[model samples]
Target: MSNYSTTTLVMTRVFNVSREKVFDAWLNPKMMKKWLFTLEGTNKVAQNDPQVGGTWEIVDHRDGKDYRAIGEYLEIDPPKKLVLTFKMPQFSDTVDTITVQLKELEQGCEMTFTQDIIVPHEETWTEADIEKALGEYHDGSEHGWNLMFMGLKELVETGQISYKG
Candidate 1:
């Protein structure tokens, strides 16, 4: 049996907007800042050459510390799908690809995001730490994604960016 494990997080949101507009929001920095990592009143995101092999970074400042993450794009298909690598500084070198898809419904547009991660060595985590970390990550995943979706909705509906959380 394999000793590796993978974690998959899927989130879906319905926005009252077009797929193209939704897609552009992610690709655009002005739109991204309105939601991306805006929690706790501190965050930053920057993307360079946001295509395949393109670079991206987000610097989060909080509690008198700076946590930085950098990555690159693996695939890009406008108004449909996007795949990108994600990496955090000082952590193990793990490549994560975020797959985002856009679908149109009578009510609005449906945006689905799936993040898949392969943890090479689960033993590196103690049982207690593993449990705590997993719980925290799961909770953050839900909260963070919801925030992003709400931001998107606000922008599309009001022609202005707003964050309720």
Candidate 2:
């Protein structure tokens, strides 16, 4: 066994738009800043390169603080799947991988989003400890992603960026 255990955050959302549009928004600079990891009125600097091995960074400036998210494209299958490394240096040095999968539906598209949360597998870490941490992460992360998804859904369907986040 490795020295780490993975806790995956799996969530799905449906959008009233094409998967291509949803996928494009992830790469588009202007569209990204409107939603990706941001608060309703917070400003962010987004730098993204969508090609495989390319890196991305989004720094959110809120309440006189800069919260940064850095990642690299590990795999990209446009309109269908994307895999990237997600890291918030200020929070942790642990680099996690996030995978997004999209499938076309009659109404629109469904996005299956997931993030791999790696926990140290030290002998001292009891099962209870891991569960407790996961509980906290699940609530915070799920809430944040829901807000972002709302923003994305609105942006793509209405051609307007409302900071639902």
Clashes per candidate, residues 3 or more apart or on different chains: 0, 0
What C-alpha lDDT does candidate 1 achieve relative to the native structure? 0.71
Q: lDDT tens digits, residues 78-140, model 2?
A: 989999999899977778899999999998999999998766555778888878777777677
Tell me the TM-score of model 2: 0.89
Clashes of 2: 0
What's the CA error at residue 157 for candidate 1, in Å?
A: 2.8
* Model 1 agreement with the true structure over 1-165: per-residue lDDT tens digits: 255445677898888878888888777766655555553256655445778887877676777877676778888899898888766756656666678999988967899988775454466677666566656655666676777677777876676764433
Q: Report lDDT (Cα) of residue 109, candidate 1.
A: 88
Clash pairs, model 2 backbone: none
Single out the weakest 10-residue window by summed lDDT for candidate 1: 38-47
The regions of model 2 sitting more than 4 angstroms off are 1-4, 39-41, 120-125
Best by TM-score: 2
